[model samples]
Each structure stands twice: as C-alpha cells, then as structure tokens.
Target chain A: MADPIDFWFDFSSPYGYMMAERIDTLAAKHGREVKWRPFLLGAVFKHTGGQPLPSQPMKGPYSKHDLARSARFLGLPFTMPEAFPVSTHQACRVFYWLESRNPRLAHEFAIGVFHAYFVDGRDISQMDVLEGVAGKLDIAPEAVAGATADDAVKAHLREVCEVAIASGVFGSPFVVIDGEPFWGVDRLPQIERWLEQGGF
Target chain B: MADPIDFWFDFSSPYGYMMAERIDTLAAKHGREVKWRPFLLGAVFKHTGGQPLPSQPMKGPYSKHDLARSARFLGLPFTMPEAFPVSTHQACRVFYWLESRNPRLAHEFAIGVFHAYFVDGRDISQMDVLEGVAGKLDIAPEAVAGATADDAVKAHLREVCEVAIASGVFGSPFVVIDGEPFWGVDRLPQIERWLEQGGF
Candidate 1:
C-alpha cells in the first residue's frame, strides 16, 4: 500500500454505510488502506442542495429496485433501512470514540447501524439504540459517549466536512486521494485504478 | 441512417433547447436522422417524481454553472427563460400540429422558443407569446390556434409522454437511437457512438 485514502462518511447515509462495509475488501484488492473520516450529514446538507431521503422523488422506485439490484451487483444483502435519516449524533460520537482506540470496531458499528435501519426497520437515532448498536459491535458505552461528546472529535467532524465542501465535494461516500474526488460507490474501481498508477 | 432516432423534448428544459438547436449538426456528422417527440414536462413529472426547475434546489447552482458551461460547450448563447416552467402545453401542441405538415417549420419554431426562453426569457406557455414566437419563425399564427384546439394533437401530446415513460425515460432531451436510451444532453457524444456502429 502507498498513501492511505480518506473516506468521508456520514452515519445516516445507507450509501456511506455500504461503502464502509465493502471498501476495505475493495481497497485490499488494490493494495491500499482506508482511513475513515466521519462527519455530520445534517451539516453537509446545509450547504449542499440535497434532500433527506423522503424528499427525493426518484427515491421510492429507485430504492425499491435498489435492494435486489445492489445485492446481485455487489453480492451483498441490502434491505431498505426503516430507521433511516436517523440521528447520528450519538452514533457518530461512538464512531469518533472507537476510532481512537479501535478503528475496526468503529467500522463494525457503522455497518451495524446500516443493517439496523435499512434491513431491520429500527429507528437508530435514539441514544439507547445507538448504544445497543455499539454493544453489538463489542464497544463500551462509555467509549461511545466520550468519543461523541469530545469537543475535539466534533470539531474534527466539522472540519472534514468543511474541507470537503471547500474542495467542491457534493455528496457522501466520496474519497479524495491525490486531489481527485471519486463521487459514488460505483466508482470504487476507478479509485483503485488511480492508486495503481501511483496517482495518490 | 438505418432508423429514426427519437429526440425527446420539453420546453422548460434549457438543455433540451440546446440539443434541439444543434442536434442536426451531430446528425449530419454521424450520418443519422432524428425524430422529434415533444411532451409536457408537467405530465412527465407527475408520473416520474421529477421537480420543476424552480422547485429543484440543486438546479439553481447547476443552472448557473450550466448557462456558462453550455455556452462554451455548444458555442451557443445560453440564457434562462424569464417565465420558466412556463406552460409547455402550447409549445407541445404546436409541435404536434406542425409535425406532419411542416416539420421544418416546427424545427424553426423550436429554435425560436429556445432563443425566446433561454436568451429573451419569454414565457413559452402563454398563447400570445407563443404566437409572437411563431410569427418570428414565419409560422402562421393560425397554426398555433389550430394546434391548441385540435383533439388529435392533444392526444398526440399524451402519447408522447406515455411513450417516454414506457421507454424508461426519466428526463428531458432524452435520445433513443435504436432501443438503447441515451439520457441527458451530455450523453450526445455517446449517442453518436451507437449511431456510428449502426446502433448495434
């Protein structure tokens, strides 16, 4: 692996969660390391003209077929999350917390949240729900609380998103390596190609 | 050209106007023929969950960038219509009417509408404005009157949108060469590629 690639993630996005779940294997296939950088989706939407799921008109039909299509394409189970657009404050806090001690655990917790909302139909915005998800990922509740509440961690989240926006970042699950913003999860193959050419 | 490629259009779409103004040049370059199909965007949106230009937040920023970008790209004066999302019923009606008798006149009128909306910012949906534009294109005002009143023309408008939806067409300026749908004006080059290959 050469230089590490940074993946900007938001807790509420199914696409972000999907990228988090599979990026590692995809990165490994190309011989690279992924550094997960969590951010607030609400903040991202403030500056960018995007919708919060229910607002996108094409969402229903596209999402209806997305599951079966995504499953078959990626070889993964994709159930539409019920507790989507969930509050990610606590979940994101846990992510910041776990990243300090166990980045792998943080990654697992994110995957758990994705499955919870889209597949299991659970509201993941609540504190208890987020904590429960952390528990499933074998993370201590205190670690999550500390990580989520830490001013520095919260600042890091804001800083990353601001950086993303300043650089003309439009949507989530985008990775910028060597100044190229790879927009969608579908562009992972293109990302691999860049790293291979030592473009990073 | 082995077959007539469908060029789907709506009045509110600047990109469609841009394509309409210059598609013939592309046709000549690739040795292809085009079949224009005009439809009401309101009907398409009602069926597909699409938003009007003013209603879409992303469109604001995108439109600002697009006007300049398209002008440079297409070598045409790109301008926004004043009374946008203007009723295209009149425009579609005129297209449907002139389609059989004088399609060349219809093409001229389409160019007139594009210049009126994008450059002059005129309201296309208004009958008076349409008649004026028709006059500018040297099309008799009676054609507009006949177009608006004819039941056959109204049915033709409905069929255009119905055919659009059935073909998985999601937006305006959609081009279908053979059975493959090339969406968006940006896909013109790719559309030409298929045309060169005899549309496979």
Candidate 2:
C-alpha cells in the first residue's frame, strides 16, 4: 500500500468540511488512506497575511454565494452558521488528543465536529459543543474537556501548524501527496488524477 | 439563445490564459457564446485589496507550481514568462479599439495576446511584441500603434475595468452566467455543469 495522503484543514472552513466529507471515499477508491490533520487557519493566515474569505469586500458576498452553490453542486447540505469563521482551537486540540489514542476514532470525531459546525450550525469553538460531538462517538465529556485544556495537546497542534507552514500549507483543504501540495477543495479533481496516475 | 456568458480576465493571469483557451469551446458546446472581457486585475485588486498570486509568501511559490501542473492537466503548453504580471493597458486599448470595429477579430487578437504572453513567453507589454503578434494576424502595425496611443481607447479600457468592478469581478478568469459568478480555472467544471443543467 502507498503512503497515506495528508489532508490539512481548519475546522471552521466550509470548503474544509466539504472536502472532509468526500476525501476518504475518494482516496479509498484508489487504494489510499487519508490522514486528517486539523490545524488553525488563523495561525496560517498570520504568516500568509490572508484574511478569512467572508471578510473581504466584493469577494465576501461572492464567497458566501459560491459556498451555497458549491454545496448544492456537491449534493451536500450546508447552512451558513450565523457566527462564521470562528476559532477552532478546542476542536483541533480534541482531534489531536483522539488521534494519539486511535487514529480511526479521531477521524470520526473530526467528521462529527465538522457536521456540528457546518450542518447543525453549532459552534465547535465552545467546549460544550465539542463535548456534545465527542459524546456522540462514545468519548467521555471529561476526556474532551481534558484535551481542550491539556498543555500537551495544545503544543501538539502548534507543532502541526508550524510543520504545515514549513511544508507550504497556506489554505484550508490542502492535500499533500508524496510531497506534491494541492490547495483548496477545488483541487480535489487534480488530487484524484494524481492518485490515479501516480503523479501527473 | 440565452445571453452570452461574460468571461472576464486579465492578460497577465496564468489561470486566465488557461480559461481563455478552454471557455470558448466549453461554452460553444452548450450552444452559447462568450463575451471575452479583458480588464486589468490590478485595478480590481486595488478595490479588493488582493495581490498578485506570485507576490505572496508561501502561496507565491505554490502558484507557480500549480500553473505548470494545471497546464499539464489541461494538456496545454505553458511557459512562465521572465517578465510576469506585466501591464496590459496597451493590450486592452488595442482590444477595445478592434472590438468596436470587429468583435470576432478582437477575440482572435485576445487569443493572440494570451498565446504571446503565456505560451511564447513574449513580453506582450512591449509595443514591438504586440506589433509582432498583430502582424501575424494581418492586423496593421500602424493601427495597433494608433490604438495604444489613442486617449479615447485608453479611456474605454478604463471604463471596461470600472464596469468589471461594478459587476463584482475581483479576480482574473471570473465568469458570470446569468449573474452567477464562478471564479478561477478550477470552476470550469461547475461552469460546464451550469451550462448543461441551466443553473444547477
């Protein structure tokens, strides 16, 4: 089997959520597995000097419209959360915590967090919301709380983000396959082609 | 026939060049025409506070790689010009000047300019290079020179750019189908689907 594809995304990113829903199945088709790495886009933006998509001028409204249209195109249900572009530190920490224990459970937890925020319109930034999401997956509330406040988990996420920057990850839904970096959910097709062709 | 699709792009954009090559054929497949609008992205960036892709930090290097990869994906030849993101004022003026006389000829000239800059690696910003491209199409060199110098033609180009901004065009290779804006060469699949399904 080939090495797992690194899927980097911020929990608050709509495109990231969309990619998360599809990447596993897409990779499975080509005999590949995806390693989901949740990182803070805000931290990455600090280095790139990029703002959230919804905060720009004319592009802001267009991005909102595009997100809804893209959702319909992908046949995925999406409701724009009233409070968008929220912090994902808690969610990332919990994900990294679960990842250390069981990678599969961590992947499922990540998906649940994405669904909570993107579909249910729940704020995963809050501990209660993340606890609710983790509870659904048989994870204890105390464990979720401990992960969020754990200094080690926080440091682990920070290291992941710094490594992401070093590897040239500037956007959410970034995929790196064999050192070839593909950014954005839009690059899904290219990633699929790359997997099928083994580097095109 | 439905209204023609509005294809907006900058002469210096790599994605725009790729879209220019494919949009016509894709639109024509759906029995639609495209209005190729060449406007200055630099002007739009001033309003949106966006910078050229190659000028940013990590994204700068990634964009160059993506351009080459995208070119291969699309089966098109691309050569990064030594002088990139050049001024297209002269090219735009000449385009509008010819457009007033002949839209078809102007479309051909637009293709010529894109080919000169992206494929041939010629500095289309230079008058001599523009003349060389124009000469091949049997367009008069003197006419090209006159259009470049004409104040009215320059003003027309400016008006075109202003209108592009008013239409919420903030990026190169932006397409609008019945007020549905799709940005980037990555949106080509969505554009094709929109044309096929008549607004999906």
Candidate 3:
C-alpha cells in the first residue's frame, strides 16, 4: 500500500472545514487513505507574513462570497459562524489527544467541530463547546477537557505545526501526497487529476 | 448580445500570461467576446496589501510550480523569464494606444508581449524590447516607442488601473462576467461553469 495522503489544516479555516468534508471520500475513490492532521495557522502565518483571508482588504469581502459560493458549488451545507476565524488551539489539542487513541473517532470529532462552527454557527473557541463535541463522539467531556490542557497534547500539536512548517505547509487544506504539497481547496480538481494520473 | 467578459491582467503576472493565452478562445466557445484590459498590479497591491506571488514566502515557490503546472495542464508552452515580475507600464500604454485604432491587433500585440516574456524568457521592461514585440505585429518600432511614452497613453493606463481597482479587482487574471468577479487562473473551471449556467 502507498503512503497515506497527509491532509494538513487549521481548525479555524473555513476552507479547511470544506476540504475536510470531502477529502476522505475523494481519497477513497482512488483507493488511497488520507491522514487528517490539524495544526495552528497562526504560528505558520507569523513566519510567512500571512494574514487570514477575511482580514485582508478587498480579499475579505471576496473570500466571504467565494466561501459560500464554493460550498454551494460543492453541494455542502455552510453558514458563517457569529464568531468566525476563532482561535482553534483548544480544539486542535483535543483532536490530537483523541487521534492518538482512535484515528477514526478523531476524524468524527473533527467533523463535529467543523459542523458546530460552520453549520451550526457556534463559537468553537470555547472549551465547553469543544468538550460538548467530544461528548457527542462518546469521548467523555471530562476526558476531553483534561486532555486539552495536558502538556503532552499541547506539545504534540506544537511539534506537528513545526514539522508542517518545515515541510513548507504554509496554508490550510494543504495536502501532501508522497512529499508533493498541494495547497488550497481550490486545488482539489488538480489534486484529483494528480492522483488519477499518478503525478501528471 | 450579452456584455463582454472583462479580463483584467498585469503584464508581470505569470498566471495572467497563462490566462491571456486562452481567455479569448474560452470566451469564444461561450459565444461571448472578451475585453482585454492590461493594468498595473502594483497599484492594486498597494490597496490590497498583496505582494507578487513570487515575493511571498512559501507561496513564491508554490506559485512558480503552479504556473508551470497550469500551463502544462492547459497545453500551453511556458518558461519562467529571467527578468520576471517586470514593470509593464510601457507595454500596457502601447496596448491602449493600439487598441484605440484596432482592438484585434492590440490583442495580437498582447500575445506578442506575453510570448516574448514567458516563452522566450526575454526582459520586457525596456522600451526597445517592447518596440521589438510591436514591430513583429507590424506596428512600427519607432511608433511603438513614441506611443508608449505618450502622455495621453500614460494617463489612459492610469485611469484603467483605477477603474479596475474600483471594480474590486485585487489580483491578476481577474475575470468579470455579468457583474460577477472571479480571481486567479485556477478559477477557469468555475468561470466556465458560470458562463455555461449563466450564473450559479
């Protein structure tokens, strides 16, 4: 079997949420597996001189429109959260903790967090909200709460972000297949083509 | 007849060159005409806080790879020019001047300029180089030189860039169709779908 495609994303990125919704299915179609790894975009942005899309000038409004348009184009449910572009470190920490135990359940937790923030318009920065999402997945709320604040989990995510940065991952929904990095959800078609043709 | 598709581009942008090579044909397939307007991205960058893709951190290398990949994907010949991201004011001025009398030849001149820069890896910042490109299109080298430096032509390009900015074009290869804006060469598929469905 080939190496699993590494799907890197920041929980705070709307585009990341969108990609998370479909990457697994797309990878499965090509008989490939995907590894979902969430990291902090804030740390990457600092080193890259990058700003969130919604924080840029003309790009701010266009991105808002495009996000909705893209979701519609992909036939996915989407709604901008009241508190958008939130700090996602808490959720990231929980995700890493869960992933260490059950990778499949961890993916479900990711979906729950994305749905809560993007579909339900809930603020995901709150630890309670993240714990609630974890509870829904049968991972005890206390277990999630405790794990999120654990030094090991926090350090794990920090190391992941550092590794991603060193690998030239400067954006969310960045996919690395056999070391070739493809960034942005818009590059999905190209990624599909790449997988189909085996690097064309 | 429907309004023509407005294609806004910068001469220095590699992606813009890639789009310039195909937009006319794409528009023709949709029974739509295209208005090619070459403007300075520098002005828009100032307002949008955008640096050239090649000047940004991780984006720089990714953009170079994407540019070549996109060209290959589109079946177009491409090469990175040694003197890339050149000041294109002179070429843009000549474009407007030639467009006034003959739009068809102006487009031909545009093709020549893109070919000289991207395909041949030539420096297009110099007046003599632009003159050479124009001369190949039957435009006199002396006349091309004279028009590029003409006060009226200079003002026209300045106004064009302003109009592009006012229209919310913050990037190269920005396409506007029926009041809807699409940025980036990667958006060609979306643009085609938009044209086919008459707006999504």
Candidate 4:
C-alpha cells in the first residue's frame, strides 16, 4: 500500500474543519489513508508572519463570505463561532494525546471538536469542551484532562508544528501526499487529480 | 443576455494570469461574457495591508511552487519573471486607454502583455514593452506611447483601482458574478458552479 497522506490542520481553522469533514472519504476513493496532524497554526504563522484570515483587513471580510459560500458549496453546515480563532493548544494537546494511543479514535475526536466549534458554535478551546468531545468517543475524561496539561504532549505538539514549518506548511488544511505539498481546501480538486494521475 | 462577469486582476499576478487565460472560455460556456478589469493590486494592498505572495516568508516560497504546479495543471506555459510584481500602471493605463475605444482589442492586448511578462519574462512596466505588445496587435506604436503617458488614462486607471478597493477587491483574480465576489484563481471552479446554478 502507498503511504498515508499527511493532513495538517489547526482545530481553529474553518477551512480545516471543512477539509476534515471530507478528506478521509476523498482519500479512501484512491485506496489511501490520511494521517490527521492537528498542529497550532499560530506557531506556523509566527515563522511566516501570517495572520488569521478573519483578522486581515480586506481579506478578513472576504474570507468570512468565502468560508460561508464554500461550506454551502460543499454541502457542509458551518456557523462562524463567536469566539473565533481562539487558542487551539488545548484541542491540539488532546488530539495528540489520543492519537498516541488510538489513531482512529483521535481522528473521530478531531471531527467532533471541529463540528462543535464550527457547526455547534461550541468553543473547543476549553478543556471541558474537549473532554466532553473525548467522552463521546469513549475516551476517559481524566486521561484527556491529564493529557491537556502534560509537558511531553505540549512538546510533541510543538515538535509537530516545527516539523510542519520545516516542511513548508504555512497554512491549515495543508496536505502532503508522498513528498508533494498541497495547501488549502480549495486544492481538493487538484489533489484528487494528483492522486489519480500520480503527480501530474 | 446575462450581465458580464467582472473579472479583476493585476498584470503582475501569476494566478491572475492563469485566471485570465481561462475565464473567458469558462464564462462563454455559460453564455456569459467577461469584463477584464486590470487594476493595481498594490493600491488595494494599501487598504488591505496585503503583500505580494512571493514577498511573504513561507508563503513566498510555497507560492512560487504552487504557481508552477498550478500552471502545469492548467496546461499553461509560465516562467517566473526576474522582475516580478513590477509596477503595472503602464500596462493598466494602456489597457484602459485601448478599452475606452475598443474593449476586445484591449482584452487581446491584456493577454499579450500577460504572455510577454509571464511566459517571455519581459519587464512589462517599461513603456517600450507596452508599445511592443501593442505593436503586435496592429496598434500604432506612437498611439500606444501616447496612451502610456496620457493624464486622462492615468486618472482612469487610478479610478479603477479606487473602484476595485471600494468593491472589496483585496486580491487579484477576483471575480464578481451578479454582486457575488470570488477571490483567487483557485475559486474558478466555484465561479463555474455559481455561473451554472446562478448562485448556489
């Protein structure tokens, strides 16, 4: 079997959430699996001098409209959270902690967190919210709580961000198939073609 | 006939060049026409605090790669010009000057300018290059030279930039279909859908 696609994203990115909703199915169509790597986009932004889309002047407003339009286009439900672009370290920590144990469960938990934040308007930045998401997946709440504060887990997340930056991942919804990097959910069609044509 | 799709772009933008190559064909498929509006992205960046893609840190390098990949994907010939993101006022002015008298010829001139700058790596900011491109289209070289320095044409380009900013045109390759704004060359698929469905 070919290597799994590296799907890098931030829990706070709406585009990431949108990609998360469909990446697996898209990958599966090509007999490929996806490695969901939830990293802190803020850390990557530090290296790139990039700001969140909703905060940039003209881009900010356009992004909001685009996000909604894109969601509708994709037939996904999305509501911009009031507490948007919140610190995603907490959610990232829980994701890594779960991923270390059960990769599948971790993917499910990531989806839950994205749905909570984007569709349900629930802030996934809070520990209780993350623990609630974990609880739904039958993950122990105490373990999730412990993982959120674990130094090793925090370091691991940081290391992931560093690796992403080193790999030239400056934005969320970044995908690395084999060695080729594709950024943005908008590149999905291109990604599909790349997978089918094997690097066209 | 339906209203023309307002296609706004910068002469220096690679993505804009890519979009310019296909937008007419795509719009014509839906029995629509495209209004080629060449404006100064630099002026919009002033209000948007945006920088050129190749100037940003990580995004810069990634943009270079993505541009090449996207060009190849679209089956279009593209070479990164040595003098990229150059002052586009001369090209814009000449375009508008020609557009004022003849829009079809102006569009043909715009494509020639894009081909010269992007494919041939010519520095289009120079007056000689503009005249050369105009000369090919059977346009009088002296008239092209006169348009390059025309005060009214300069004011017209400035007004175009102002109008672009006021319409929330923060980036090049932005399209407006019946008041719906779509940004990026990546948005072409979505634009196609909107044109087909008349807004989804």
Per-model DockQ: 0.11, 0.89, 0.72, 0.85
Residue B69, model 4: lDDT of 95
After superposing candidate 3, which stretches have Cα over 4 Å from the reference? none
**Candidate 4 TM-score versus the reference:** 0.98
Q: Write candidate 2's Cα lDDT for B59-130 as tens digits.
A: 999999999999999999999999988999899998999999999999999999999999999999999999
Which residue runs of candidate 4 sit more than 4 Å off their true CA positions? Answer: none
Clashes of 2: 0
Q: Which of the predicted structures, 3 or 4, would earn the higher DockQ when compared with the native?
A: 4
Ordered list by lDDT, greatest first: 2, 4, 3, 1
lDDT of 1 by residue, B109-186 (tens): 877877778888877778888899889877778878988999998888888888877776667787776776655665
What is model 1's DockQ versus the real complex?
0.11
Please, what is the whole-model Cα lDDT of each candidate in the order they appear? Answer: 0.70, 0.93, 0.89, 0.92
Docking class of 3: medium
Point out where model 2 deviates above 4 Å: none
User: Can you give the TM-score per candidate against the true fold?
Assistant: 0.60, 0.99, 0.98, 0.98
Question: lDDT tens string, model 3, B57-147?
Answer: 9889987887888787778899999887889999899999999999999999898989999998889898888988988888898888788
For candidate 1, lDDT tens digit of each residue in A1-200? 46777787776766676677778777777777888776776776787556675566544454444434444455556666655566776666667667777778777877787777656767777766777888886667776667767898887766766876676555667676755566556555556656676542
Fnat for candidate 2 (0 to 1): 0.94
- lDDT (0-100) at residue A146 of candidate 4? 92
- Candidate 4 lDDT tens digits, A72-152: 999999999999889999888888988888888888898999999999999888888888888998888899889988999
Assess candidate 4 and give its lDDT.
Answer: 0.92
Candidate 1 RMSD to the correct structure: 7.5
Pull out the clashing pairs in model 2.
none
Winning model by TM-score:
2
